[model samples]
Target: MKKVMFTGGGSAGHVTVNMALMPLFLNEGWSVEYVGSAQGIERELVGSLDEVNYFPISTGKLRRYLDIQNMKDPFKIAKGVYQAYRLIRKQKPQVLFSKGGFVSVPVVIGAWLNKVPVIIHESDITPGLANRISIPMASAVCTTFPETAEQISKDKTHYVGAVIRQELKQGNRDRGRNYCGFHKNKPVLLIMGGSLGARKINEAVRAALPALTENFQIVHLCGKGQLDPSIGVPGYKQYEYINEELPDVLAMSDMVISRAGSNSIFEFLSLQKPMLLIPLTKQQSRGDQILNARSFEKAGYCRVLEEDGLNDASLVSGVMEVYNKRDEFIGRMRNNKHSDALSAVFRLIKETAKHP
Candidate 1:
C-alpha cells in the first residue's frame, strides 16, 4: 500500500487541516502516519483515530521574542530533526504533508534529507516562522489565501483555499437548537475564542452579555477552564469546549463572533456564517489574526473589531452590526471563488504522492 506522513501541532488550528485531509488518504487505502510533539493536543486528537499511527517527536516552541528558552530550543529542534529523519528512513513514506507549526519544521527537514517530496500548507496571509523556514525545502506550498502565493516562488505555490471538515457542512439545525436548550424565537449568536479560549474576548463578551442576550440567544465556547457558572441567564449558554456538538451549534447560529484564526475564519466563510472578527493584537500574536481579519473584511465576508478596540460597548455593537448586515456577508461568501479548496488540496496530495 502507498504511505503518507502528516505533521503539525501546538494549537488546534495547526492540526485541523491535517485532520480534514487524513480520512481522505485513509479511505484511499494509504497508510497514514502523524509526527507531532508527545503531549500536544494533536496526540490526543490524531492518536484516537484508528487508522493513523502517531509518532511523538521532540519540538521546541518558536518564539519571536528573546527568552532563556530560546537557548535550549536549538538543541531540542536538532534532536527532533534526527528523530524525524530516523522515522522517515524506516517508514519511507511516498510524500510528507505538513500543516505548518514549529513541530513541522524538523519533519520537513527530515523529509528533504530523505529525498521524499514534501507539501506544506499555509493557512494565513503571511507565512508563519515555521512555514517560512520550510518553504524552500518543500516540493510544493499550498495556500489558503491567493495573496500568500505571490510571496513564494510561483512554480511551487498553489492557492488551494482552506480545507474544511465535511462533517461540519452536514449539521442539523434542529438538533443544535435542542442541544443548546434554545427556542426558535430569537436569533442565535455563537461566540468562539479559538481552541485555548481568548481571555480578553471571554471577559468582554461576558461583560456585555446582558445587552447581547436581550437581542440574541448566545452560545459561548469559552475555551478550557474559562467557564463561569455565575452567569445563568435564560438566553445564554456556556461551554468550555465542544467537539461533536460544534457543527450543530454552528448550524443553529445566525451569526458568529470570533477570533481571526485563518482556519476558523475560512470555516466560517465556507459555512456562510456572518462574522464579527476580533483579531489578536500584535502584543498577543504575530498580528496574523489581524491580517486574516482584514483580508476577510476586504472580501466583504466579515466585520473586524481589533483586540485593542474590544470592550463591553464595542463588543455588543460589533455583533449587532454583523447581525444586521448578515445577508450582505452571506452573499459575498456564497460567491467566494475558493469554496472548492478541499478538493484542490486532495488532488495536490494525490498528484504529489504519485509523482514522488
Candidate 2:
C-alpha cells in the first residue's frame, strides 16, 4: 500500500485539518502514520484511531519571548531534528504532510534531509514562525486565504480554502437542543473560546449571563479546567469541552460568540453561523487572531468586538447585534464559494504523493 506521514501539534487547530484529511486518505488505501510529541494532545487524538501508526518524537516549543527556556530550547530542537531525521530515513514514507506548529519544523527539516517531498498547510493570513521556517523545505504550501498565497512563492502556493470535518454537516438540531436542555422557543447562543478557552471572553460572558439569558438560551464551552459551578442559571449551560456533541450544539445555535482562530471561523462560515468575534489581543498572542477577525469582518461573515472593549455591557450588546443582523451575516457567509476546500486539498495530496 502507498504510505504518507502526517506531522503537526502544539494546538488543536494544527491537528484538526489533519483529522479531516486522514479518513479520506485511509479510504483510498494509503497507510497513514503520525509523528508528534509524546505528551501533546495529538497523542491522545491520533493514537485512538485504528490502523494509523503513531510515532512520538522529542520536541521543544518555539517562543518569541525571552526566557531561560529559550537558552535550552535550541539544543532540544537540534536533538529533535536528529531524531526526526533518523525516523524519516527508517520509515521511508512516500510523502510528508505537515500542518505548521513548533513540532512540525523538525519533522519538515528531517524530511528534506531524507529527500522526501513535503506538503504543508497554513491556516492564518500570514505564516506563523513554524510555517515560515518550513516553507522553503516544502514542495508545496496550501493556504486557507487567497491573500496568504500572495505572500508565498507563487509556484508553490495553492489557495485551497479550509478543510472542514464532514461530520459537522451532519448535525441534528433536535438532538442538539436535547443535549443542551434547550427549548426550541428561544434563540440559542453558543460561546466558544477555542480549545484552551479565553479567560477574558469567559469572564465577560459569565458577567453578562443574567441579561443574555433573558432573551437567549446559552451553551458555553469554557475550556478545560475553567468551568465555574456557581453559575447554574436556568437558561445557561456550561461545559469544560464537548467533542461528539459539538456538531449538534452548533446545529442548534442561532448565533455564535467565539475567538477568531482561522480553522474555527471557517467552520462557522461553512455552517453559515453568524458570529461575534473577540480576537486575542497583541498582549496575549502575536495578533494573528486580530487579523483573522478583521478579515472575517471585512468579508461580512462576523462582527468584531476588540478585547479592550469586552466588558459585560459590550459583550451583551455585541451578541445582540449579531443576533439582530444574523440574516445579513448568513447571506454573506453563503456567498463564500471556497468555504469547503477538501477536494482541492485531497487532489494536491494525491498528486504530490505520486511523484514522491
Candidate 3:
C-alpha cells in the first residue's frame, strides 16, 4: 500500500487544509500519518481521528522578535530535524504533504534528505516565515490565492484556490440555533478570535455586547480560557472553543466579527456570510491578515477594521454598518467563483507520489 506523511501545526490555520485532505487519501487505501508538535493544536485536531496515525516531534517557534527563548530554539529545531529525518526513513512514505508552519520546516527538510517528494500549501498571498523557508525544498507549491503565483517559481506554483472542509456545507441552520439556545426573532451575529484567541478582540466584543444584544443574538467563540461566566444575558452565548458544533454555529449566524485568518475568511466567503473583519496588526502578526482583509474588502465580501482602531464604540459601529449593508455583501459572494481546490490538490498529491 502507498503511504503519505503530513506535517503542519501550531495553529488551526496551518492544520485545516491538511484536515480537509486527509480523509481522501485514507479512503483510497493509503496509509496516512501526521507529524506535529506534541502539545500544539494540530495534535488535538488530527490525533482524534483513529484511522490516521500520529507522530510527535520537538518543535520551536520561529520568532521574529528578540527573546531569550531564541537562544534555545535553534537546538530544539535541530533536534526536531534529526528526529523527523529518522521518522521519514523508517516510514518510507512515497510523498510528504505539508501545510506550512514552523513544525513543517523540519519535516520538509527531512523528506528532502530521504529523497521523498514534498508538496506544500500556502493559504496567504505572501508566504509565512515557515513556508518561505520550505518553498525551495518542495516538489510543488499549491496556493489558495491566485496572486501568490507571482511570488513563487512559475514552474512550481499551482493556483488551486481555498480548500474548505466538506462538513461545513452540511450544517443545518436550525440545529445551530437550537444548540445556541437562540431563536429566529432577531438576526444572529457570531464573533470569533482565531485559534489561540485574540485578547484585544475579546475585550472589545465583551464591552460592546450590551449594545449588540439589543439588535442581534450573539454567539461568541472567545478561545480557550477566555470565557466569562460572570455575565448572562438573554440573547448572548459564549464558548471557549468548539469542535463539532462549529459548522452549525456558522450556519445560523447572519453576520460575523472575526480575525481575518485566510482559511476562516474563505470559509465565510463560501458560506455567503457577511463579515466585519478585524485583522491583527503587524505587531501581533506578520500583516498577512491585513492583506487577507483588504482582498476581501476589495471584492465586496467583508468590511475591514484594523486592530489599532478597535474599541467598543468602533466595534459597534462596524457591526451596524455590516448589518445594514449585509445584502450587498451576500449578493457579491453569491456571484463569486471558486475553484475545485480539494480535488485539484488531491490529484496533484497523487501524481507527485506516483513519480516519487
Candidate 4:
C-alpha cells in the first residue's frame, strides 16, 4: 500500500480540511499518517480515527511581536523540523499533502529535504506564510479561490476550491430544520467562529439577542471554552462544538454570520448558504481572513463586514439585506464549485507510490 502523510494543525480549520480526505485515502488502500503538534486541537479529534497513524511533533506558533516568546519560536521551529525529518525518514511515505499552518511548516521542509513530492492546499485568497514558503518546494499548490492562483507560481497551481467533506455536499435542509427545531417561515441564522469561536462575534450576537430572537432562530457554535451566559437568547441554541451536527445546523440556516476563516467560508459555499462575513482586523498579519471575505464578496455570495462595521443595527440590516436578496445570493452561489481535493491527493499518492 502507498503511504501518505498529511500535516496541518492548530485550528480545526486546518485539520478538518485534512480529515475530509481520509475516507478517499482509505478506500484506495493507502496507508495514512498525520504529522502535527501534539498540543493542537487535532490530538483530541485525530486520536479516535481508525486505521490512521498519528505522529506528534514539537511545533510552535511564530509570533510577530518583539518579545522573549518570539526569540524562543525559532528554537521551537528548528526542533519541530528535526522531529519531522526523523518521522518522515522512518515512515518513508509516498507523498506529503499539507494544509497551511505553523505546524505543517516543519513537515513540508522535511519532505523537501527527503525529495518527497509535496502538494499543498491553501484555502484563502492571500496564502499563509507556510504555504508561501512551501510553494517553490511543493509539486502542486491547490487553491480554493481562482484569484489566489496569480499570487503563486503559475506552473504549480490548481484551483480546487476548498476540500470539504462529502457529508456537507450531500446535506438536506428539510431534515436539518427538524433536527435544529427552527421555524419553517422564520429564517435561521448560523453563527460560527472557526473551530474556536470569535469572542467579538459571540459578544455582538449575544448583545443583539432580543432583536435577533424576534426575527430569527440562531444556532451558535460558541468556541469550546468561551461561553457566556449572556447568550441566552430565547430562540438560540448553543453548542460548545458541533462536529457531526455542523451540516445540519448549516443546512437549516438561511444565512450565516461567521468569521471569514477559509474553512468556514468554503463550508458555506459548498452548502451554497448566503453569508455575512466579519474578517478580523485587530492584528496586522491577519490578512487571510480579509482575503477570504474579499474573495466571496467578489463572487457575490457574501457581504464583507469589518469589525467596526458590525454594530447591532448593522448586523440587523445586513441580515435583512441577505433575506431580501436571498435568491440572488443563491443564484450567485450556483456558479461556485469546489474541487475534489481528497481525490487529487489520492491521485498524487498513487503517482508517488508508482515511482517509489
Best by TM-score: 3
Regions of candidate 2 where Cα sits further than 4 Å from its true position: none
TM-score, every prediction: 0.96, 0.96, 0.98, 0.92
lDDT on C-alpha atoms for all candidate structures: 0.91, 0.90, 0.93, 0.81
Q: Rank the candidates by lDDT, best first.
A: 3, 1, 2, 4
Best by lDDT: 3
Ranking by TM-score: 3, 2, 1, 4
lDDT of candidate 1 over 1-356, digit per residue (tens): 89999999988899998998899888889999999999887887787688899999999989999999999999999999999999999999999999988999999999999999999999998999999999999999998888997789989999887889888998989999999999999999999998789999999998998899999999999987899988878889999877778899999999999999999988898899999999988988888899999988998999999888889999999988889888899999999865677788888888988987
| Candidate 1 runs further than 4 Å off | none
lDDT of 2: 0.90
State model 4's lDDT: 0.81
Residue-pair clash count for candidate 4 = 2
For candidate 3, the C-alpha RMSD (Å) to the true structure equals 0.9
Model 4 / residue 335 / CA error / Å: 3.8
lDDT tens digits, residue span 89-197, model 3: 9999999999988999999999999999999999999999999999999989999998998999989999999999998988889999999999988999999998889
TM-score of 4: 0.92
The whole-model C-alpha lDDT of candidate 3 against the native structure comes to 0.93
Task: Write the residue-wise lDDT of candidate 4 on 1-356 in tens digits.
Answer: 67888998888878877788876788778899999888778876777678889999888776556777777788889998899888899899988989878899999999988888888888888788777877888988878778888888888888766677777766667877777776688888888876777788787777787888888888888888877765455678887777766677777788898888887787788788889998888484557788778877888989888887778878878877887888999998987655776677556556755674
Worst 10 residues of 1 by lDDT: 336-345
Worst 10 residues of 3 by lDDT: 238-247
